[model samples]
Target chain A: MFTSKQMHLAQVFLKIFFRDRQSIIFNLLFPLIFMGVFVFFGGESEPINLGLVNNSSNTISQEFSELVEEEPLFNVTKGEESELKRQLFLGDQTAIIIIPESFNSIDETAEIKLLLDASQVRQIGSIKEAISKSLLSIERSLRNTQPMFMIKVEDVKSRPQRYVDFLLPGLLAFMLMNLSIAGSGFNIVEYRRRGILKRLFVTPIKPQDFIISIVVSRIVIVLMQLSVVLGLAILLLDIKIVGSLLSLYGMIVIGSFIFLCLGFSFGSIAKTQEAIRPIVTSFTFPQLILSGVFFPINSLPDMIQPIAHILPLSVIATGLRDIANDGVSLLMINLNTLGLFIWIILSFIVATKFFVWKEVAG
Target chain B: MNIIEVKNLLKTYPLPGNKKDSFNAVDGITFNIRLGEVYGILGPNGAGKTTTLEMLEGLKDINGGSALIDGLDVSNNAFKIKEIIGVQLQANEYFESLNLSELLILFGKLYSNEINTKNLLEKVGLLTKESAKPKELSGGQKQRFSIACALVNNPKVLFLDEPTTGLDPQAKRNLWNLVRELNVGGMTIVLTTHNMEEAESLCDRIAIMDKGKLIAEDTPQGLIDEYASEPIQETLKGNLEDVFLALTDHRLRD
Candidate 1:
């Protein structure tokens, strides 16, 4: 897939990338600065907001609710079942517990339903352990030594929501997106504006070879970027890799290809260096804010969330997060990967269709 | 024997505001160049000299007629023609971070050739400043460097588009010397220029173009004797500039 000419060009591009001060600062240091800001402000721990819906008027159920309210692990909010469910849906509550009507009955096993959002996956073990401990104590107080109640856990598969574990993967995707779009797009436009492309067009160099060179260089840079960001994140933020490193890198390469195609499309369309900035920014800014890079996609307004989910960056972030945080296999994230594949085809077509070697005759 | 053959070459561009209306930029112009000779296309701005060179170099498409370079159809075998031809555009800026030697090597790799960077730089008298980037070189040095890049593949035929347009006298003389040296080494040269002295001193034959049409084609002295034979007040005999003025009826800069 790579020729010697492409390799040579890629090497030169790498040298240029390293020596160019603006490129160094933009591609490498910018992401680190963002990561530092996120860590400084978003690192502080806050008490989890727990919604408690008491369905039973029995004294025992009421007492159990009070016990949950006293627990420091939770900031309990007492509310009606429908109202609390709405809060959970809106991300106001981390989890909700429903105390059934038969809670204090010794003859029956009271099923207490515990509903959690998928974003709170990290806290599941701790939350479940705390609830079980509270129920066991109540069981002891009733003088039935055997287990008297059961907790049924229901996890709402909402958008993969928040914190450093979530933000790190999204940050990785965001960096690759910027590197691909701005790096290739701006560079190609500059080449065209300076007559470099026209000069190359006069040579025996094939167009596909030139494109392959760019792809190789960007993929190499993307790897270096991943290493620096992921290395620092793991060391400084104590982020654990739940999935294979191979899978994570694989997903990142796929994402880099898609965005590079998009960059080429922008490059071909834009005739000058100044004209490229707004075009690239128009595409990247929305994804940066709405693609769940720093925040969850669910936090976006309902109508926008659907659009955000289908964004290239969003799909990449979701894929990387699934692999890195949840230890999900590549196959598990097929839907996200499929979305990226579609983007690859679409952007590739645009890149090729509009590619111009020289200014058209007016 | 002719190395290049052209018949009624044409390049049409649509009128800016109206797609249905159009004008020819290189309107049915025809000329040919013999093997191993320096041929110059002389014209004012927008005479379609560059467009003609571009069409022959396979950089622009042919709209009306056929162009053959070294027996290969230019439109059908653009890449094949590119393999045997070297092109120096009027203006160029190479990769900013790469030095002359590095840029030479990179261009060499594009043709799958192993270039001796020092020898190439020395040929252009830029050996000492080779480690400097393209942006660091002066106007003449950059022009020389651009020529050096065009020579990377050791092409049989070289096309230079206004190679010394913005160069100072010293730089321009240096480039003329370089072009002569390359021609002496048996490479066919084709160039476009607005400088009359450059055309008379460097080119063996000159073709004058005006408003997308070839007006005159002859050797420098032949053109002077045929079109500009009337002795002017300033000099005893006319030069290529007088011939150009007589043929085009306008100054080269205009």
Candidate 2:
């Protein structure tokens, strides 16, 4: 599908991209620096520390303490009630659970007082669910008969996903988006302002061939960026790739195409290099903030979550995350794939409609 | 025989802020350029000289009339015309990151031709600076390199738009010499400029445009004899500048 002329032009563009120090710093080095900062601040996930205070001297309490101790998700420590509360206050423990004296009583209901650290409130829901599951198992065994109502749970095999695992995919998406948009947008505008496009237009090359050359160059750049960023994450940060590399690369290609089309559209609309800055910034800045590149989408306000979920960057980030973290195939993420396709069609239309070979005086 | 035939050529641009209102930039101008000849279009700024050249070069669309280059209609066969024509714009337009040799090779590939970059650079007197990027070259060197880039395809017709507008005297003389050499090599050259000396010295025929209309066209000497034969102060006969002043009734700079 590519001609020798397009290949030659693409090679020239690649040479220019590498020779320009600013482009190198912005596209490659900046992403690595951000990854470094995130890896430093976002430390490895540690098991939750739970302090257990058993006031009941019954078999039920003993069995519960043993069960909690065997769980890998928590570090359980048995101690006095006051000491456990003091540990919780001192941030040594995520929560303190006190088994009341009435826990051994057969007729009366027993209440467990769970004192949790406020700063670790995000773990409250999971901690409560785990504790309740253990208590229900103990109660059914103690009755020595099959319970009339029982809930069956199926465990799906998957690795424990860490914050860095999540951030790596988002970072990849971020780099691709920035490189495609700024690389194409700024370069095209500069070409127009300098009359380079006019110079090329007078040649025998078709406009489509020119644009194809840019796309080919950008795809090559995206591949380079993927290697450096993903390689660094895997080698230095000990990141494990759960999904096939092919799927991740495929998603990246789609994402870069969408952003590149948007860049072309923006490049053709703005008349001067100065005019392009605000236009590109307006489109990219909001996506950067709302796309959940550095954080999870659910962390955003409820009102803005819908908007964030539907953004091009968000869809790309989510798709990469699904494939990288959960080992999901490209076709499995139907909605994300569909969303990206929609963006590609929409942006391609805008780009072709607005793309100009020469700037005409109005 | 004529290699380029232009008849009632017109290009209209919509008036800013009003699409319904428009003005012609090249209004009903008709001219022809013979094979292997240097033709010049002279006028003041905004007289549409550059616009006229652009239409014939197939760089701009023809809004109202027609132009044919080498038996191919420019409007219908724009790409075909581009293949046979080389255009050098006014400004030094090139990729800043690529050296002259690399730019030449890239342009050569665009025309699907295998070219000798060193020979092209040597022809433009920029052979020694082939490794230097466009930004690193001096103003004169840059203009020469632009022409070298245009010649990569061995074009039949060369279009230069104000090639020496911002050049020093030495650079201007060097470029004029290069143009003479190219013309001597049997290349058809078309140029637009406001410089009267350049027109009189280089062009075999001159067309004077004013406010989007052609006022006069003939050999430089023919024009001097026809409209500017009156003797001026300190001179026995008037020159092309006097012809311009007499026909337009305004200075070339105005």
Candidate 3:
């Protein structure tokens, strides 16, 4: 018989949350709230304080200046060459459009020169190309009523994904690792500290059952949170997941177990929260950043790639990206799956070995 | 019959860095607590009273010695022993939001034989406070609730560690009374305490230990007799507490 002991344990688990719903909200829901608030309020920031510096005072300059002024991407500024450079260096000017001091007669290879803040390389590239094309069209239109040669810069009006969609998956990944890590870490430490595991030494309950119950509960809760968020995302935003929902769910659940095992291993040895917290953060933060929670892992150093590629979140994020965007089965991400499995196994071995039931002295 | 049997059992865990440094919290102490008897282990703090109690309760590793409960080795057959013994830990409590009734049902579900929650709650005089959360209850009430939990499994041996250490006088009296009531029902009780009054009033046999060794063991009267203090002078009179109880029907709660 499993006995009411297991049921009592379940009650204990739920009761812990019930006792501190406020703390739970702060710990589990705080990151999500911040993500939502910042995402919604600051969605796709408009290019603030845009400027275009024009050096030449010719008709093309005047016409192009007017065109650039009309576009939302630029707040056209007419200035001397030094003034534009000074503004660009001071972070005041976004870009400078310099028309060479040439005769209006040399209409054949009229090159448009743009001086942009070096920091805005990506923005400058797109903006400069569009401006050059627009100028060509405008220059052509002036000569002929049929517009012999016209260059018009066009900023494509393709709408970007809303901030919520951009952020929710990352938020989910962050929360999953965080909760599983917190739950398993604190629960096991508590077991040792409160002498519960020491007490369980008197029972038939193996350490495995205790560990399994905790990991299973955490994974279930993670899935529950994912399902709710996933359903809401589909209903509210008309977001459609490209990959198999089941595969994503399975990967996430397995990832939670990996984090849980990591937490338990830490918890078993650490007697207090103060002791294991820094260790937990050491594990969580590096994996969080290197796992590419917010950005691409490839952006980091070449040396870090191997380490980053192995984190559970890294693999999960890749799997999620593939599933949600590419519509591929998780098994296709075999190397990543194996990497996470290695992490789970390695953490468990170390943790189980070092875990003392109560105090080492006890 | 002896319910607890222990012999030359020893435990030594290697210290982290040094091969020579080892803590013998209980060292190699040995003793037995018998059936239906109130046995007490008295010691100053850190003298291994708690360690000894834990070992008997199967909460500690029997490093280099053997401890048997009802002929079952404590180290090897913990679960079988757990079914027969109940333990009330010193700092054990709920998550603070669990009501008395909810906690009862939760622990009640842990055993093959469950105690009637209503009856136990009433017996502890917390029947009216069943819906109150653990935090909402006073210190006295919390202790009562804990004892109630220990009894939920209908354990034959009940182990209480410092059960009434921090309670007020009247509350302590109530605990002493409760201990007597449980003993009357044929429960074998072994407890650890530093309070001499508790030992004198509740424990039928008292064992005083120091430096992980049992220095003295005898009945309470016999112990008083051994020390050559007249029995009445050394024991509680049950005087003011009973008088106060008669004058005010309500129990002193906190």
DockQ of each: 0.46, 0.45, 0.31
lDDT of 1 at B135: 88
Determine the TM-score of chain B of model 2: 0.91
Error of 3 at B124 (Å): 2.1
Q: State iRMS for model 1.
A: 2.1
C-alpha positional error of residue A297 in candidate 2 after TM-score superposition, expressed in Å: 1.8
Runs of candidate 2 with Cα error greater than 4 angstroms are A44-158, A356-362, B234-254
**How much lDDT does each candidate structure score?**
0.85, 0.85, 0.72
Specify the highest-DockQ model's number.
Answer: 1
Give the docking tier of candidate 2: acceptable
Q: Report the lDDT of model 2 for residue A303.
A: 99
For residues A1-362, write the lDDT of model 3, one tens digit per residue: 44345545654775566467676656656655655575567666554344555556777667656766666545667668787788888878766776665624435565556667767555566666666665555555555446545467663624335555545566567778888877788766665566555544443344555565566567766786667667766786566677788887877877787778777777766668588888888877887788877767887899998888877778767767667655678777477667766877886787677655434314
Q: Candidate 3 regions off by >4 Å?
A: A1-8, A15-20, A23-45, A52-64, A70-72, A78-92, A95-168, A190-205, A331-333, A340-362, B9-19, B112-115, B229-250
**Candidate numbers sorted by lDDT from highest down:** 1, 2, 3
Lowest-scoring 10 consecutive residues by lDDT in candidate 1 chain A? A153-162
Q: Per-residue lDDT tens digits of candidate 2, residues A1-362?
A: 78988999999999988888786766778878887877787775566788888888987777766776776767889999888888888888988778887778555678988888777567578777876676566666655668788667654654556678888898899889888987678888888777888888888888888889999899889988788889989999899988899999999898899899989888888878789989988887888889998888898889999999989999999999988988899878487778877888998998888886644211
Winning model by TM-score: 3
Model 1 scores a TM of 0.79
TM-score of 2: 0.79
Better of 2 and 3 by TM-score: 3
Query: Which segments of model 1 are wrong by more than 4 Å?
Result: A45-162, A356-362, B234-254
